[model samples]
Target: MSYYDVDAILTDAEKVPCQFELDVPYLGHLDNSAGLKPGTALSLPLWLAEMLALASAGEDARAPLTLNLPACLSEAVAAALKADPRAVALRDQSAHLYGVGVRMLDLFDERELGAVLRRTWAVRAADVGLHARKADEAVGGQGAEFLRGLEEWERALFRRGHEGVRRAREWMDRVKRS
Candidate 1:
């Protein structure tokens, strides 16, 4: 994720499940308590969680916290995508679902999760391309529902596909006139 990418910034702000592995006396605000106790589960922004989860205390000490897959990339969502990628409303899950998934993949080694994410992206990208090509006609129809569900990555893909189609049509018109 690039430092200047708006989507990346937003993804970093997405909350993920985390559990404190060590007591933190002054960090209770994270869980609305007096202090964070060991084993205290909390929802923390990806940025903070990543740092805490990776910070080493000593040669033999565990990291301060453990990170869990965010709800957007949970098993239920994966199963839904596996069942029907098109039917899922990705934006509802998280506007930066793919971004969070990518970060989680970097920290974890779940090959099945990675494969499911790849398949979902491939299926949805093709659908986005199709919708982009027919954007004008699909604006007020059922396609609108699908279009509204696209996450940031798919939305970018749709814009590029739409622009390519429009440019191709313009070129074709000029050639015909010539």
Candidate 2:
């Protein structure tokens, strides 16, 4: 995927903010340190809110943050997945769900949202008489196809990014070896 695709996915996933009210004074840490006072209203990223909700729930006493999931989430997911299984891009769908889920990992029960997306897509695909494909294969297939279709400069950017990551891994390994 191009940088634009990644950017779009992030932007879309973060568009909905999770709403919550702090019941206790929050000193705040790096990820969520906003110096929120008691009874203060805080609107944060869905992931962050979910995390805070999970954290507060672990405590024995009354929870500190009252977290509310977006009212439209279920509807939105259903509409998108059920509308057009073939028209929808599985990679983008997976990426969007992953971004949302990563932020709100603690909120999930038995099945994560990514798994839900996979299941939803599978159902839709089956309904449309499509063949079953592994989620990894679908995502990788898109990237491979995109790479093959990219222009010279785009291909170069992808290669440079790959090489940078490889070098970074090697450097970390060398440091560890010392």
What lDDT score belongs to each candidate, Candidate 1 first?
0.93, 0.48
lDDT of 1 by residue, 1-178 (tens): 5779899899999999999999899999876899999999999999999999999978998999999999999999999999999889999999999999999999999899999999999989998999999997758768778778999999999999999999999999999999
The most accurate candidate by TM-score is: 1
Model 2 clash pairs? 28-33, 47-103
Candidate 2, 1-178: lDDT as tens digits: 5667654445344534433355344555523756665555555655455556556554565455666434333556545655644444444433344345434444545244456555554554342222112222343665555444332323344556556656777899999999
What's the lDDT for candidate 2? 0.48
Q: Tell me how many clashing residue pairs each candidate has.
A: 0, 2
Per-model TM against the reference: 0.96, 0.38
Query: Distance from true position, residue 102, model 1, in Å?
Result: 0.5
* Predicted model with the maximum lDDT: 1
